[model samples]
Every structure is written in structure tokens, then in C-alpha cells.
Target: MSDSIFSIPIIAGTFLLAGVVKGVIGLGLPTVAMGLLGLVMPPVQAAALLLVPSLVTNLWQLLAGPRFGALLRRLRGMMLGIALGTVAGSGLIAGPATGAATTALGLALAAYAVVGLFGPALRVPPRAEPWAGPVLGAVTGVVTGATGVFVIPAVPYLAALGLARDDLVQALGLSFTVSTLALAAGLFWHDALPLQAAGASLLALVPALAGMALGGWLRARVRPGTFRLCFFLGLLALGGELAWRGLG
Candidate 1:
């Protein structure tokens, strides 16, 4: 890891911004964090710093929801697929192909941003979820392993499941939580998660929590739709630059 790129102020600030995004939108912590941090560090190192804050915050969201048990039973197969897919790509972090990982991360973010900006409010019939859930989860897990970003199809798929607003938020939390844990296991498997990175991630939690609180407060004052649009545009630009740099 580059000493300059992996500094305290940078990590703290990146996570703070990510938390704000997640707090306002109910998702985007990993996506935003990876997009920003990926500019300065390798994907695997960025992922190492991502684990703690992402896990803790999303875990709270998971347990705070109203329909925890029911959602679990409903989404079990998807969870299994996430774990399996993550295992399949575990060695990615331990490798030296920084360009490959950066390109993957950039493409994922750009695609996700495009979807958020223009994707329809799709609805998945109840009958389709049994199979659709696992397939999407596997794909999300593969993306997570490759880039440390967890949203891709998971968010859209969950939105399509016809969940109410609260359920959607909770489901995002649940899926992100599962993704975080699975990624952590993969990193640990390849010794990518060292003590220093763990400490930095933990240190970042304070700013993340504070930013979440700020975002929650802002939700009432600012127009959410506008904020969301700007956020997506920012991601699209950032992702494009990253991809261009990596490709070059």
C-alpha cells in the first residue's frame, strides 16, 4: 500500500462522505467509498479499509428493520449464493493486478450510477423472486469480491421485489451486511486484511456514524430527488475517470 494514499485524514474523509450518502439515500456507502478511495489506493486495500464501517452500519440497518425474520426466510437462497460467489473470487484481493481491479471497480460504479439515474421502477412478481434472488445475489457477490461495491443488481432487484419503503431500506441493509461479511471472509482468506487496515476502518466508524446522523437530519431539509441525481452524476463522472485512468 502506498503510505501517502493510505493516510488517516483521507480514509476518515472518504468514509464520512460515504456515510452521508448512505444516510441520505439508504445506500451508497460502499459504492461512494470505493469510488473515491479507489482513486488513491488499490481496490483490495480500499476494500480492507471498507470492511468495518460498512459492516457495522449495515448491520444496524439489518437488525433495526421490522421484518427481519421474514426477510431472512425469504432471501436465504440469495445469501447462500453471495457466500459462494465471494469464495469464488477471494484470491482477487491477494493478486497484483491493480489495473484489472480498478477497471472492474470503475465499470461497476458507472453502471450502477447509470441505473440509478434512468432505471425504471421495475417490479418482480412474487413467483420470480425464489429464483431471481439467488441469481442476483451471486452476481452481486462476484461484483463485491471484484470491486468492494455491493449495489449493482442487488438494489434494483430488491426494489423490484415490491417491498414497501421501510422494507426496501431494511432489505438494502440486509443485503449490504451479507455482502460486507462475505467480502471480509474473502479478504481474510487471502491475508489482504491486515491489522493496520482494520484499525483504520474502525477509526473511520466515528465519522461515518456522525455523517449518517447529518444525512438523516438533511433528509428533512433538502430535496431527496435532487440530491440523489447529483450523487449519481458524481459517481458517473468519478467512475468514468477511474476507468479511463486504469485503461490508459
Candidate 2:
């Protein structure tokens, strides 16, 4: 979408809010930002606008800590899944299949939010199989590339792996960074990435970075259960809105 007078403030406010949430939670910038932006911009444009900021923030997250090598080794399979799924999803976005994918994304996000809120109590048996990470990562990659939804399928797998909270957050951040860059490239190849979209995405980096910082700080002080509750609720609301828009 072009930067019209009406869209400027909307874009700024969306990023600001998205930044704050990401700053507190270590993720959700794209989910929250794209959700809001979808109200004002086309779904594809909203997803595109989040590309630059998401890429930058994820790069920082991936590189920010000690034990990077160990973490990478542990999550390597998932990363591979992310790569495969991202390519598949991005290819789908180029055809007439986008609408069905978008609608499914909206519903998936909604289901994720609901399950995240209530299903943690019902733990699935943890799998020791090597294929788990790849499966989860691939699913996350597809959802992310197609609709900017990153938390589904992957979050449960991450949790199941018993990763330290910090590790989980960092891994997710890195995964998103890689997947978003790939998706953006795919969009560009398909002539979907315009200069205006790139500019807006770059501008959004400011708030996204700020929010990531804030979220990292907050993660320590907040109760994990409470934070999850609130975050999932936010997701639910966003997902519901998306579904409504799609159906309408």
C-alpha cells in the first residue's frame, strides 16, 4: 500500500504497539503488527511491510547470546524444516492459491491462540525422534511465509524439547529471521516487493527493535504463565479479526 496521509499514522502506531509487545515477549512483532496492518492494508502488503523489521530483529536475536553454536546444533533440524517449508509456502503465494492459504492461516492462528491458552495443561508425550524439529519447523515456515504467522506448530515443539526459555526465544527469533528473508526474496522474485513496501518495512525496524529490547527485559520480571495467557489472548483477538475480515 502507498503511504497516504491516513496510513502514515496508522503505520507508526502499529509498529509502536508491535514493538512494545515484541520487546516484552521476545516474539509476536510480526503477528501483532501484521494483524493491525491488515486492518488498513491488504493482507499481502501487511505481511510484506513486516519483512524488513522482522528480519533485522531476528538477526539480532539470533546473534545476541552465548552458546549460539550449541543452540544452533540443537535446532538444526528445525532450521532445515523451516527452509523447506518457506520455499513451498512462498511458491504458493505466487499463484491464485493465496486466498485459500490466507484464510487457512487466519484459522490456524486462531486455533493456536485457543490451544495455547488452555492446552498447556494437557501435555503431549515428548518425542525423542529426530524428525520432530523438522516437522515443526517446516510447518512454522509455511505459515510464516504465507501469512506472517510464526508461533503455531513450532511453539509446542520448542516447549516439548524442554529448551530453556532464553534458548527457545532465541531459536524462534533466528528461525523467523531466516524464514522472513527467504520469503521476502521470493516475493521480490515474483515482482511482489515494491519500493514503497520496502521503505515502510525499513521504517518499521525502529519500533520492532525497541520492542524486542523491552520484551527481553520484561521476560525476566513477568510470570511465565501470565505472560503466556495475555500473549495468547492477543493472538486470539488478532486471529479472530483476520478471520472476520477474510469471511466478510
Candidate 3:
């Protein structure tokens, strides 16, 4: 799938649609893009192609908030843990065993959908966050290395931090940036990412950003919770399919 000329349209369409979802919901660009792209491409290659758009968009999110210094100071531990854990698990993806990585991606997607929709509303006190942040970030980093999906515990962890609405959004950006870069490092360590994939990843930014604009327009005119429900359902179904394919 990576070598085919047809992959270009697939990549663009996937990112554009995924960007739309992210613009509307304020998250899920990589999740949705990987889920869809996984159908036609290897998870490793798909993840590689995600680098440019994902990093660019996430950096935008990271710097968009007001409390970046405060957030960075607070999340530095988690960021470091993520980097370490990704390096630790760099061998999990790409290779003859990548089917396992695909299956992990599927499970991660399903888990994220479930958690996003009905997960517990646990709260973390300041003391707990100091320890919990690094632990959860490491766990998420392992998952990201294996599957390139990093939202599971990270999102829930941030949600529990008692941050304001906008702060939470910015926090997601920062966490995503770290995760994306960590995955990039992991792919590079495994020698799984190639120059062509990087070029494709760079090209993906145009459609992704365009789709985000469209989604933002829809966001203002439509209800967010309603869109979110459908989004989770889609993730559930896609995750199941990917898992089944991986296991088969």
C-alpha cells in the first residue's frame, strides 16, 4: 500500500476527513487517520506518513494556549517518561510482527472510544499527579510505540487534572506533540520510516488543514456532543474491524 500511486489520494482523503473530525471535536486526527489509513497501508507506514501533519497540527495546538509554561512545567515528567518508554518499546512495530502492532492499534482505538464515551470520572489531586503523570505517560508511550495511538490514558489523565476547558485543550496539544515526536523517534530507531513517507507526510498537511477549516465551520453550526457520539461509534466499529483483520 505504501508503494502504490493510489495511496496518495487515500492519504489525502484520510487526513482531510480526520482533520475535519479534529477541528470539530478538538481531537482525534491521528486516531481517525490511522484507523482509516490502516485499512490500506501498514500501520508503521501509516504512522510514518502521519508525522508532518500530526506534528504541525499538534504544535499549533500546543502553542495556542495561554498556560504553556505552566503546563510544560507540570507535564515535563510525563514528557520525559514518554520519550524513554517509546525508546524502550521501539521494537514493537514494523517487521514481520507488525500484525500484532495493528491489532494493538485496533484495541487501542476501541479502548479509547469506550473510555471517551463511558470511562470513569476519576480526579487526580496535585500529589497524585506528580507520580501518576509519569507512570501513565510511560504506559501511553509504550502503546504509542506499538500502535502510534497515544490518547488512551493520556486524555483521561489530563481530564482528571482539574484544568479549565481551554487549558485541557492546550494540554492535549502538548501531550500529542510529545507523543508524535516520540513515535517518530521510535520509527527512526527501528529504521522503519523512510524518506518517501516523510515526503508524503509533508504533503498531507494541505488537505488536513483544509479539512480542519471545514470542520471548524461545522462546529459553530452544529452540536458538539452529537458529533462526538457518532465519532465514538465510528471508532468502535473501525477498531473492531482492524482488530479482526489483524487477528485473522
Candidate 4:
């Protein structure tokens, strides 16, 4: 949506809400904002609007944790895969094939929701890391490049690493930060992200941060598992709608 007095408030409110969700659960800002905003605007525009806030917040989340070096060392392969895969898939945003892209994005989201809700959590043995890391990361990157959402095999893969809770949060942050940067580069190459939209995306960060602060305070008191359930359910519904939009 174009910047206007009315649209600006809506944009801010969407980011505020998405930020609160991210603050509580350590993810979902882009998923929530892009999914909801897509109803009124182009999904690519929604994805573009998410760029600055996504980068700033995710970087903040990554740096706030203690395992930056170790996580980097551990996930190096995956990170490399994400960067390359995102670039490879960048043409989807620039091409005229958006209908197919959105369909794939919807299916991916629905699959992610199913995995989160009912699937067993699997553990990856240390020995498998060499091969598994790049594969999962590349898949996650492809999904992010196509859909503007980054959680998929990546989240489950990271969780499988059996990190401590804080480490998992930081890992998500690290992955998301990489995904955000990669997505930005992809969009720029595709010419989908204009300079004016970038400026507005930067401005959207204020409300996002504010909502994050509020959510962080509430996180101490809320049951995250409950919120997680709601989050997935919401995603499932949104995914269904998006899929329908694409198929219809």
C-alpha cells in the first residue's frame, strides 16, 4: 500500500502486532505481517516493508544472545546454503510467475504448521551435521526466497541440534537475520524493492520495536506454549487462504 495518513497507521499497527508475536515467541514477525498485509497489498510489497524491521529486530535478537561465535561455527554450512539458495530463487520475485510462487509458499506454510503441531521432534546426530546442515539451510532459503517466510526445515533442524533454550532463540535470530539480508538482496536484484519503500520500511521499525518491548515484558508472565499453538493455528488458516488465492 502507498504511504498515506491512513495507510501509515495500518502499517504501523501491523508491525506492532507482528513484533509482539515475535517478542513473545522469538519468531513470526515477517510471517504474520506479510500474510496479513497481503490481503490489501501485494505480497512483495508486504515483504519489502518487512525488510528493515526484520533485519533490525533479528540482529538485535542475535546479538543479545551469548553463543554468537559458536552458533556461527556450527551453522556455517547452512548459512552459506541459505545465501546461495536465496540468490538462486530470487528470480521468482522479479518474474511473472508469482501465482505459482504464492502457491508454493502456501503449501510450504501449511506443511510447516503440520510439522509443528503433530510431528515428532527428531534429533540429528553430530555425525550427520556435515551433510544435513547445508541441505536444510538451502531448503529453508528457497522457501524464504519464494514466500517471504523463513521458518521451515530450518527451525526444526536447529531445534534438533538440541541447543539450550536461549541458544535456540539466538539460533533462530541468526537464521532470520541471514534470511532477511538474503531476501533484501534478492528483492533488490529483482527490482521489487524501490527506494521509497525502503524508506518507509525503515520508518516501520519504530512501532515494531515498541511492540517488541511490550511483548518482551509480557513474555515473563505468559505461557509461550499457548501462544505458540495460536501462532501455528493462525498460520494454518492464513496458509489455507493463500493457497486458495493462488489456486483459484
The number of the candidate with the highest lDDT is: 3
Q: Compared with the true structure, what per-residue lDDT tens digits does model 4 show for residues 167-243?
A: 99999999999999999999998888888889889999999999899889889999999988988898889888887
RMSD of 4: 1.5
Q: Please tell me which model should have the higher lDDT, number 1 or number 4.
A: 1
lDDT of 1 at 189: 86
All candidates: TM-score? 0.97, 0.87, 0.97, 0.95
Segments of candidate 1 deviating more than 4 angstroms: none
How many times do residue backbones clash in model 2? 5
Q: Candidate 3 — which residues are off by over 4 angstroms? A: none
Q: Which of 2 and 3 is ahead in lDDT?
A: 3
- Clashes (backbone N, CA, C under 3 Å), per candidate, total 0, 5, 0, 0
Residue-level error in angstroms, candidate 4, position 58: 0.6
Q: Would you list the C-alpha lDDT of every candidate in the order shown? A: 0.88, 0.74, 0.89, 0.86
- List ranges where model 4 is wrong by over 4 Å: 1-6
- lDDT value, candidate 2, whole model: 0.74
The lDDT ranking, best first, is 3, 1, 4, 2
- As for candidate 3, its clashing pairs are none
The digit string of per-residue lDDT tens for model 2 on 1-248 reads: 86488887788778877777777767777777867776666667887888888888778877886667887887888888887787677755544554555565577678788877776643334465367778878888888667766677776666666667788777777677777877787677767778888988898787777766666777789886788788889778878877776776
- Name the lDDT value of residue 232 in candidate 4: 89
Give per-residue CA lDDT, model 3, range 146-234, as digits (tens).
88887878999999999999999999999999889888988898899888888889999999999899999999998999999999999
